[model samples]
Target chain A: MILPRLVFESLLNRRSTIVLTLITIAFSVALLLGVEKVRQDTRYSFSNTVSGTDLIVGARSGNLPLLLYSVFHIGNASNNISWQSYQHIRKNKKVAWSIPISLGDSHRGFRVLGTNSDYFKFYRHGNKQQLDFEHGKPFAALFDVVIGADVAKKLNYTLGKKIILSHGVGKVSFSDHDDKPFAVVGILKKTGTPVDRTVHVSLQAIEAIHLDWQTGYKNPAHAVSAKQALKLELEPKTITAFMLGLTSRLSVFSLQRSINQYSKEPLLAVLPGATLQELWSLFGLAESALLIITVFVVLSGLLGMLTAILASLNERRRELAILRSVGARPWHILVMLCAEAGLLTAGGIFVGVALYYLIIIAAAPVVETRYGLTLTLTGLSINNVCMLLITQVAGILIGLIPGIRAYRMALNNGITIRL
Target chain B: MKNQFISIVMLMVLTACEEPVNSESLQATWEDLIQEGFTPKELILKYQIDTYEADDPRRMQLIRAMEEEWNSAPVNENLDNKKITLTGFIVPLEIESNAAYPTVSEFLLVPFLGACIHVPPPPANQLVYVKMESPIAMPNDGEAFSVTGIMKTESVNNELAEAGYNMKGLSLETFSNESLNPNTE
Candidate 1:
């Protein structure tokens, strides 16, 4: 008790320096934990975007690019699969269900996905969860569109609202399809996926809107009214990609091989789970690099504490000599120094964790809205607890440096004021 | 007091020398999982399946007959409900997509690696569907693991219908070269 009191009083004597060291450690700790949390959540949200589908088929392209463009809406597909090939593949007995996706249009900044009602029925995400309607129902008429949660909220769209789509996938486009506007028939619930930022319309509506733009430009002479365009054949000729659910998972490899070998048109098929793992492994390199850098930041923080303690030892030599004269032992001084380090580390960890929660609470919504990544407020996982334990032990181990030096000084100058 | 201390140390050493009595005793190999009196090679030989040319119409009939024999091949019932350890490569069935690391809770344990991609997967009886209580970091491709569990002869007719055996895995360890010939000792 007396030794702890002396250590506490000693720490208080240099309050400013100790507090500064603690703040450095706290900031470093918070940064380390924040990076790890965001990395974990990003991977989680990425993987949760699509599930239960066995294969994603698209025009011949790299698997990663196809996955990114079709599922994540991150890029454009290199080419479109002919509607004939999609029909032929979906007709195979092994295919349980298929959902065709046509891209290359946008409303405001959101990508417009042209698909049939089968998407609402068969498409799954995040543990096979089905998309539920937040308001209204799936599109019943050809001109009716279903907006995702983000589009509805960001654009302030309601049921029966009229919105026109652009000719291409850009925020600002000159070729606006002002001739044919879609009615918002439904809004999907928040899914924390790219689906939340998409605008869904029927395939026929896509064809209708692009009727006059067949020559890559809307000709004034050939302009067709929206009502007249509906009377024409609105069958889609090509699609960006399509997802397949096989009757049996055992046939996935076989079907994928056959799709890749389709002689009529060059095509590519990839198993979603396997491709996702491959994609994540690529990101794993960058994730590890970030973690390593943050770890070094923490190491430097601990080293700063060590330097502060070691520098203070020179000024505390007289203090130790006085204590020795008052009958304090060398080991007592050692344990007291270690205890002080332990206290600073523990205090820093507590404030760091509190600061971590504060940042998460303040930034989670912004992260979710801006990046579509959900930052879950989970309790300290086993990995976190282990890291904190290692940091605390390192701090105490660092204390041993100054501890042994002070021990030597106390023994060498017993009962002498060397200052 | 010195004698007592030496005797206590000796007792500890003796106890440490004794091997632990493991509850699981049956060490099932790929050969043991096969149904008695049934072999794909024997069927192929008996039907002259390899003798016909690829374009021959008779060859398709013989191949279909061989497939029927393969599909109807039953699991070895004697090993049912037995506590056993089997070593094999994994084919993940239930991937936890949200994990930072690739994690799987359910997977198929096949006798050989690359069974999923390679043509003509192993017989149904040779594939064991293993379900772990919790998800574990998925092993790299072609890596093998030895799983200890209670084996069942029941069929799992889920999306992955290739499995002829189901196992409630209790524990697992990475298969090493030393464990390759487990019965040698």
Candidate 2:
């Protein structure tokens, strides 16, 4: 009891210095935890975006670029694969299902994806979870469109709301497909992926809107009305990319090899998992660098506390000597110093955890909306708890330095004021 | 001092809770996976593979026959449902989402490095589809792992049918040269 009182009184005497050291420790702990959380959540968000699909096939391009453009909607495809080639490949006996997607269109900054009903039936994300409808069903009519949760929320679209798409993939487009407007029939539930930023319609609808824009601009002389265009042939000539689900997982590599070696066209087939692993390998160095820096920040914070305590030992030698003359054991002095360190470390950790939650609560929504990465709000993970424990242990060990020094001085100069 | 002792004991208990490697697991070599007396080199020689021109129709027939033989190759029934440890390179089948690292949950364990990308893949007997109990960080290309699991002789068939062994992986460890030549022990 006396040890704790003595430790508290001593800390209060050095309140200003102690408070600054506490803040340094708290901030470093918060930074370390924050970096770890962001790294984990980013990986989680990206990985959960696409699943169950065995392969993503596109016109000859790098695997990472194809994955980004086709699945994540982060970039544009280099070229389009001929519809004939897609049809021929889908005819293979090993293909369980296929979903072809056509890009290069936008509606109010959101990408417009052209696909058939197979997109809803076969596409999966996050542990084989199927996409569920929030409001309506899949697109039934040729001109009926389906919007994702984010697009619907941001744009304030509802069932039967008519919206026209732009010809090019940009926030603001010069050419709008005003002649052919699509009615929103379905709204998908929030997936926390790029799917929430997509507008989906049938391949025919995509072709219909571009009927008069063959030469990259509207040809008014030969323009077809929306009603007339619906009656004409609307088979898609090309598709940006397609996803494939194989009948057997074992055939994936062999099928990918065949597709890559296809004599008729230059194409690339990549396993989504393998390509994702490759992408993470590219970021592995950066992620490790961030973690290492945060660790050093934590080390410096502890070192600061050490430096302050060691410097204060000189001034406190008289106080310790007087206590020794009053029959205080040398071990009692040691325990008091240890107790002070333990309290500061525990307090710093508590404040740091509170601060971490405060920052996460404020930034989660912004991160989700801006990057499509959801920051999950949960209790501290096991890893975080372990790290905090290790930090506390380190803090106590640092206390032993000042503790032993004071013990030696109290024994040598009992009741003597050593200036 | 008593509290310190208790915390140390608690740590020991926590570590002890992890699943231990089964002591009864049989060490299996890649050769044990293949059908007895069937060699790829001998098969190629018997089919006169080197003599055929690139466009020869007979060569195509021989290739098809070889594929059929490879698919139909029987797995060792003695090893079925037995706890076994085998070392091989990995070809990831399923990767877990939301992981800070690229962790693989399901993968194919092949007898040779580059088996997935190379022109010729191992036969059905030589391929083991491993489903891990927990995901592991993705290993570098050509890195080998010693996997312990219960081996099952299962045929996965679709329109284009394929047959291979399945393994419910219990544990995985990095394979070293010491594991290859156990006589050194």
Candidate 3:
């Protein structure tokens, strides 16, 4: 309406001042939107870490640690469940599917998971979606390997490539399984989870490679050669734990109770969702810290906006009085003033989203290779939509005080003979 | 009143087919036994110290010595027939590079042994994959425990013929059974 023209005219007349105000509003919008996008993406990434998993059963340990080791691939497990216990739990009628995991091995810095083909068939990420193959297929016929997307790309692996494993779980591996090289059979599609950085092979593969080793060193006196070692049986005696899925969700608790209370052994069963929540609980302090930082940033932006606008408004008294003398309504002045805030905020939001999308696209490879977390450029998640709406509402509300003052100024000027 | 009547009817319908078990207490749901004193080891089989931290010599010494007991012979169900208490972490089993066979969800309990950060690495055979039918709460504090359970070992495998513990009938774990299901609420 008339307010937009008035607002534009005011902006044109004082181009430099309005532009500065607009810039400030734009930065605020960018910060708010950018932070919101990151938060939403973080939650999205976390939820997708272990998709398609019905349950992650492990030793009776803290949920976060279990998740930290199993899903996020951070840290290591403190205790191990007895191999005997794993077999008994797997026999339950409710367990329709399961995949055993063995950790504490690494190739270079990437984690080495001693698993089987069941992992390739049943394991999923990114919202219960099955793992898609980028190149090749699941590892089979023993000593064959499957690399994650990030691993293959970073290491520049091709089909039927050979790689060595280390005795330890990190970059500085002591004993390299140089003798028992593995062939790459498959490369997984990008999963946006920790699986991307992982190097997976059969449990038998892990054992076959390590058979001649003892305490990270081969016995100098006598040893079977790698080919000779192959002749020896390579079935694994122990593993880390397994993920399970059941036909009925209701039977989970009963099945869980059965495992924990099985008179024959000491076993712990866990639900993946509950453990993840418990793990995030310990991260509450970090979340609080982030919230505090965000609050300060928002307050600073608002304070800067308030000071800049008020300073400009004080100097525009004569213009306001002229409008009042010209028979313009006070409400019109109010609308004109607040409209500037809305416009500037909108512009800011546009720029911030553009920047984030650009960054996500540019840094995709870097983030993937390093953290094994994939960042998608899909704009405006549901949470982001809600956030933007909230931000716009907040911007408008903050503009109201300045609007009312402009209205009062117009009213006072009407009788001052300024016309 | 109409709303209340409908809500009650809906709740009843949901619970209609389920039978309640009142025989066992909730405490029994978590624990089946309490362990007694450790049976004194004869000469405490000699072991080398693969110590991670030097601060706790007692724990390190005990675990180092116990490593022999862990790896020396297969866990015998009839040994001592005396309730023995042992405290350590329930860690995930490491991938054994060479085994006759292995099964799913395999693991092994180590007595305060180090993780990736502390120790060099656990031997493959010492590792075990854990499985529990029921979900238990995981621990936040890194405290070891006094767990009591009859230990057993057996060969098992999937279609691929992996072998490991036949850990079916293990009893109540203090913690570590968390669920991954999204809470409906």
Model 3 misplaced stretches (Cα beyond 4 Å): A51-54, A126-128, A172-174, A216-223, A247-249, A262-266, A280-296, A324-331, A363-365, A381-383, A404-419, B1-185
Highest TM-score: which candidate? Answer: 2
Native-to-model Cα distance after best TM-score fit, residue A247 in candidate 3, in Å:
5.6
TM-score of 1: 0.85
Tens digit of per-residue lDDT, candidate 3, span A96-193: 79899988789878899989889988886653579889999888767788898878888899998889888878677777888778889999987767
Q: Which regions of candidate 2 deviate over 4 angstroms?
A: A219-222, B1-23, B48-79, B98-103, B113-118, B123-125, B133-141, B155-162, B178-185
Q: Please give, for residues A5-33, the per-residue lDDT of candidate 1 as tens digits.
A: 88888888899999989998898889878
Q: Assess candidate 2 and give its lDDT.
A: 0.84
Model 1 segments more than 4 A misplaced: B1-40, B49-86, B97-102, B110-131, B148-171, B178-185
Best by lDDT: 2
Indicate the residue-level lDDT of A136 in model 3.
Answer: 95
Q: TM-score-based ranking, best first? A: 2, 1, 3
Candidate closer to the true structure by lDDT (higher is better), 1 or 3: 1
TM (chain A), candidate 3: 0.84
TM per candidate comes to 0.85, 0.88, 0.63
Ranking by DockQ: 2, 1, 3
